[model samples]
Target chain A: MKFTYQINGAEHTLTLEKHPEGYRAHLGTAIYDVKLLHAKDGQLHFQLDETRHTAHLAHETPAKRWLHNAGRTLVIEKAATHRRGADTAGGSGRLTAPMPGQVRAVLVAVGNEVTAGQPLLLMEAMKMEIRIAAPHAGCITALHATEGGSVNKDDLLIEVEEIPT
Target chain B: MPQFDRVLIANRGEIAVRLIRACRELGLSPVAVYSEPDADALHVRLADGAVCLGPAAARESYLDMNKVIDAARQTGAQAIHPGYGFLSENAEFARRIINAGLVFIGPPPEAIEAMGDKAAARTRMQSSGVPVVPGAQDLADDTKIQQAAATIGYPLLIKAAAGGGGKGMRIVHSAADLLEGAAAARREALHAFGDDRLILEKYLTDARHIEIQILADQHGQTLHLFERECSVQRRHQKVIEEAPSPLVDESLRAKMGAAAVAAAKTVGYTNAGTVEFIVDPVTRDFYFLEMNTRLQVEHPITEAISGLDLVHWQFRIAAGEALPFQQADLTPRGHAIECRLYAEDPANGFLPATGTLLKFSTPPGPGIRVDSGVESGSVISPHYDPLLAKIIVHAADRTAALQRMQTTLQDTLALGLTTNLDFLQAILAHPVFVAGEATTHFIDQHLPNWQPAPDIPAAAIIAAALAELHSPSATTHTTASPSQDPHSPWLRLTGFRMGGGE
Candidate 1:
């Protein structure tokens, strides 16, 4: 599968695949052999090695460096995440979850005018505290998800109508 | 042997991400293994492939070696790199890897076995003129221990022979403290190292913990890669590490290097390893402690100073290649220091805390190198080592290195999750630390409520409030009346950098 992330307002495509060693990512790929066990609050976990990292990763997500692409705003992700010199679209933008979280605070009413990189709302996944920033100048034309709702991979929270001129 | 085009990292967090980079450098495809909790992990998204291993508890996932090896086979992986503190040091697991015909990128099982038992290694080193500390010959037999104590003198250390990291060890200042200390050491040794056999050693006060890096190829060219001063520690666990120890003059370095070489040679070692020693600061005398028969957590510091690729060399040596560099060619350059980033509260006695990472940041500048295993949206649990990342700084001199460290820490931020940030900051500012006079007991001597000084006062609390106010994810957004609810919904924002994610 592929994901498009914006860096400083430039959209970069990322290709993510399922792990061969039994990993299944909803947005990426499905891996066989690895199993997922359910936990408290319907949380699923997986252990990778014959040690504790898997568990640590499950409970402690942000501490894992591998998940951090450590690059520009638009990280391609994956081994191919090293794409440089890619063209930046003039009118492209994105609004991603600021923190790995669910949408908890959607203060914007649709069709509201907003500047580039303006604050949209709050994403509340993983106890992650991020003020989702607008990717480009636009009007809040559509509300994709509702406040006080749970969302997953690629769940659209809100849509912006690109403002011409 | 079938070559696997891609090898999946069967873990999450910073180590997993670090391994993925290493695999990329090694020309192998990396598969990221993650739990449902880590769906957003950087390693998983970055690897060529990803797999869900199991649930969050260690027993079901990372410790599930079968699933891991099977994942490798399923991914058509030819080898697996077990990063430290996980399956990286498990000898039985290594045997299993060999039994299954998958390359385990670590030392041979026999070598691991030899050194795993601290007592056994002590015996081997003693015979090889490795100058081990004087201690009891075996687990304390009441009578034998009494005699050994009388012979070895007072102020002895009862340690688990097969232990590493300060687990299963105790200091006995007198005969009155002997039996209890012995029991504590024995029990801890049994649990941590799975070996109950222990020995007593003469405890030297104010000893600078130092170790020499060594690399051995299959053809027997074992080279010493100088020494690292790991004197800064807390509870016997190393906290800060630097190469070409400040206290080690040329003569001391030469002597210690020779001893480390002898120790590795005697063991017929064939991989990147570390031989630890206790150097008495007052007299400048040193004694052999133990040998770690694998790459160390502090290897990057050694690499920073020596300009060597220990991991890449491990892979090369495993591939049956002659060491590319000769012993005479190896030399260290500028000084380097490493501080471990852990998820614990020093104010709360370093108690480990688990939560989703709210913010993560790291400093990026010249002479700063960082190795981490976690990212944003990642959760911290109590299932593994509390360490989250390692921040290393290199500079032309010790003073510059110290300054560099302070700068790096100031720029780094770990928000949401509790961490030892304050502890590390306190350690950096310690009087003894400033003067370059540190020992393993450094943390014990100077920590009660270790905290990092914010560039401004009330920075943490105010930032939390501002972040909550501006946060797009704040569910309650009750920064105003945090006292209203029991949860005390305080919003946490880490600095905008790569090193601050806790």
Candidate 2:
């Protein structure tokens, strides 16, 4: 079987085939004798060549998986054959929450003009207050965050449209 | 006075758990109080009885003194222990507990009030012959504050009089920024501590934060538990702590300890408290910072070295017990270090991350201790502190202790949500930290642009790929008998499993 996997935004082609001794697997340019002992609950215990290893994986979404191994976490995704263009182009004008938190204060209104580094809102998380600043000088076209509202990571907070000089 | 069988812990998190353990060892039943969000907290689970205070907001729960006292009454607890944060230093709370005929496992309300005000504490320290940093006190307006700032020279700090945890602190480098800085500081102080009073102090650019732990009894006995160096801070909040301070010597420690004892005596402080100081590295001069009239978050390091349980002593002292040992009999054993594990992403501006902890495995071994309030499946909410745990280690010497701490941190496994674990490891391995030269500005100066490891290792990539391939979904696509095939080469290999064999 062959598949394309995206690890940390980089894509790699991997192939696996049965061998007399375990299985022969080709990942990118390297090939190894992959002996699968067991796989369940997002944990894979296997032997690569002579070395033993365990990897934990969590299904994040249809296209994304969180892989934890070697004291580090890497987000891996099954590469999609088709690309969506609207999502990529629409991100520039939107402000998203950097982390999960509560919006303590919203300093900008829908029609407010803001500078690139002007303070836009205050977020409170982990008992610490953080000031979210505007990314660029623009007119606030939309405000999605309300005072004392909870926000998750990547939640759209506001939308700004650039003001033509 | 009544003999209390049950102690009420009017707090949440690790300190509450710590108090519960102490109470159990002391033959006292512990009753826990929790907010709605913390109904299933570890502390609550460990206690003999638990009561829900209110909602998730601290104001409605932890900081609500009446609610806490009422919970204690409802639980039939004769004594109340307010762990470090929340109402620990609230004088009114202490008074209420005492008025409710319950022993407050801490100093008297007067002592907390004296040390609670930074300006008042400085005045008391100076009068008691302790060295205090030169600055303005009790300035009524910004004009006077600016004048005082000018007299104190540039680079002075404006600190909240009623602040702890660096909530409202600002540094002014010149006259141009003094007024605005004071205004910002006042605004934050009012918001965080409910007190807008500000005090100015001479900013020591290269000073080290050293604090002496003082334990006193109602019998008028007082002793110092030496000092802990808390210089490694970010935004004036301590992240790492150890005892004794690398900057202090025999004579310096004695001097600082004496001053701390004097400060405690002047305030008639009872129970456990800490007198903080700012030490000039070059001249070895120390100035009084403020006295914390409650058990500190980093008290474990002191326990590791002294072999004494501070919380247990707090209970005993509250019960009118005398000091067990004299100043000469107590000797610190060895070096100990503590690192605060926070739910934060150091790579992304150290912002706090909130999510359910998917995996939480603590490092266990000799000379290692973990005081944690969280575990796997625990949700880190935004309404409370992000301190997940404290990883502490002790060894025969500083070098050995550092090594042990490094190994323990590396072995620690906490997945899901971002954390400062990797960032902490980087600090521990830094050359300056190894040399014991990390001052308060070490993190800001050395790692101003520090980033987490950008890429995964080759082995990890391969393992991840293989794990994905052998996932249940992928296996379902293959022949079912392949997994059980006696002739299958995979059967020849040793037992291997993925996804924890679920």
Candidate 3:
């Protein structure tokens, strides 16, 4: 079986085949004899080639794996099946919450015209106040976030229609 | 003199744990108060008794004077200890504790109020013969502000009168930006601290932030425990702190120490406090900044160098104990450095990151100390400060201390969340930091746009792949589960191993 993973915006491939003695693994252009020594409780002890390695499985999900090895932590994510469209190429015209936080204030109202780089909202997260700015000059078509309301990551907070220009 | 058999700690996280340890060592039972979300916190688990104050919002729980006092009353605690943040420096809280017939393990309420106001504190420091930064206050209108700006000249700083931690501060380098800067600063000050008053000061370029630790007793005996260099800062928040600054010689240390002692004595301060100063590196001239009426977060580095337990002394002083040693008997022995481990992304403008700590480990060795609040499986909530732990190392000299700090940070691992560990390592390796020439602008002047190394090692990739193949959620075609496949290599595995490859 073969698998593809992304780390730090770069992708790598790995293949594994069962063998009578252990397993044969192919990573990038290198092949190595791999044997699992132990695996339990989010800990994996394996021998790759002639070196023994132990990696702690910090977190695991269907699309991501967080591993800790050699005093460094790395996050490996499965390549998304469908790439996101270039919504941010020019401007998305739709603003979403970048992280979970509370809306401290709403500086703009519906139907109000805003210029690119102008602050439209204020948010409080992690004990710091963050200013949410307009991605492009546009007319506010909808406002979904209310003052003092909590929001989740990627939740749409505002929708704007670009002024014809 | 007041004697207490039980003490209630009105704080959470690492500092609370530190105080609890102190209370236990002093033969007093320690009680803990926590919010709803912090019921399972390490501090609560380690305390002799625990109470639920209120909800998770600090305003309703940790910062609520009524709730905290009630918790202490219900727990039968005779004294209350407020750690660094929260209500530690609130004068009203201390007053209420005293009115409730409970001892407040900190300075008197009068001292807290005296130094809590930055503008008022500056005036007092000047009257007490302590050198203060050239600035003007009590500007009630635009005309007064303009005049003050003219007197202070260009490149002045507009600061919030009721602020600390660098909030509501703006640096204006030209006269044209004075009014606008003051207005913006007022708005920020009102938003952050509920006060819109502003002050102007001459902005010093290339200054070092050195603070003296002062311990005072009720018997009018005060002593200074040397200095801690906290010049490495970002957005005015301290990142790394060290003891016995490399730039300070015997003569300079004596001057600063005496100034700090005088500042504390003027405020009638008792217990452990810090007097922060802004020193010009070229002339070695220092100006009084402010006096913190409570224990500071970086007290561990002072303890490392002075070989004195500050928390223990705080308890003793609050109990009306007298000093056991004279000023001539105390002297710093070695160098110490501390690196704060925060749950924030240095690559992304230092935005705080929140997640569960799936794997948490601290390095263990000689001359190393880890003061942490979280463990494996702990959740990192966004409701409070992002500080996770502090890694401090002590050695014979500055060079050896820096080397030990680098090794210690490399050995510490905190996964499932973004951290400043890599950024701290980069700072330790920087030539400017190595030469001990770093000023308060080190992060901005030297490493303004630091990013983590982009290359991922082959070993990490292999480990990730193998872990995924063995995960229970993996597809049956790729998974080699011992339950489903008896001939799988996982079934042949026997003993467990730890750590990385040699």
For model 1, residues B379-409, the per-residue Cα lDDT tens digits are 6777777888899999998889989988787
Fnat, one value per model: 0.00, 0.13, 0.27
DockQ for each numbered candidate: 0.02, 0.07, 0.12
Of 1 and 3, the candidate ahead on lDDT is 3
Best by DockQ: 3
Ranking by DockQ: 3, 2, 1
DockQ of 3: 0.12
Top model by lDDT, which number?
A: 3
lDDT for position B317 in model 2: 89
TM-scores of chain B, in order:
0.87, 0.92, 0.92
Predictions ranked by TM-score, top down? 3, 2, 1
Candidate 2 local lDDT, residue A163: 65
Error of 2 at B484 (Å): 36
Stretches of candidate 2 exceeding 4 Å from the true structure: A1-17, A23-28, A36-45, A54-67, A77-165, B187-196, B472-502
Q: What is the lDDT of candidate 3?
A: 0.83
